[model samples]
Target: MTSRFTELSVDCHDPERLAAFWCEVFDFKVIDRSEDSVEIGSWVPTVEEVRARQMPTTLVFVQVPEGKAVKNRLHLDVSPIDASTEDEVIRLLGLGATRTDVGQGPDRSWVVMADPEGNEFCVVRSLASQD
Candidate 1:
């Protein structure tokens, strides 16, 4: 059998806050919650057990210790699901992400930004727009 990806789990300091931030960024909903953990999924679970078993296919956030240090390699790139790159960039910036200057010139393609937790990601021009 072929392997199928289930979710991209992130170890964060605050699950609820990060989930909320991501919810605004991706228009995702909080499908389930607990005292120490919260799971954000694209689709809502119909039942408790379903929620427990539900794993988001695209991305998921899990709470971790406060003192954990992120190495110099953590990052995630996101593409607009339904909106144009420009629109998505505007939406993400409004959600709390701040632009970072990583030595890439202003005219260099792609918009680079950092999430609330300081993880960097890029939004590239849409494929549809390149055609």
Candidate 2:
């Protein structure tokens, strides 16, 4: 059987804080939450309706006791939906994200950044800018 990509589960020390941070970063809302986990997603008409339509994936943050000790082997790369990457990067920086260096050379096409919890993700050039 074939499988479709769905949720991305992240292990963090603070689920609530990380979930909130990701929600702000993606313009998503917390759809489900528990004592040790939070799931955030873009709003759709209804859960069943959205599921039937195969909505986009959501991010689930789970609380863990330990902090990040190394670089993420699988990290996210985000591009602007309506604005330039520069503007988005500036806004993200204002939201507590910090620029990070992960051995990517200066000539890289994307800018690597770390979240409040030191999870590394990239901000790539916007589609409009590439066009």
Strongest candidate by lDDT: 2
lDDT digits (tens) for residues 1-131 of candidate 2 = 43445689999999899888989999999989999999999963365665566668889999988989999999999988877888889999988899999999899878999999999999998866455
Candidate 2 ranges beyond 4 A from true positions: 44-54, 128-131
Worst 10 residues of 1 by lDDT: 47-56
What lDDT tens digits, residue by residue, belong to model 1 across residues 1-131? 33444556777788788889988876788877778677776875454544456444645677777643543365666788677888888988888888877677889668888778766788886655443
Model 2: which residue pairs collide? none
TM-score of each: 0.70, 0.88
Worst 10 residues of 2 by lDDT: 43-52
Off by over 4 Å in 1: 44-58, 67-74, 81-84, 102-106, 127-131
Q: Estimate the overall C-alpha local distance difference test score of candidate 1.
A: 0.73
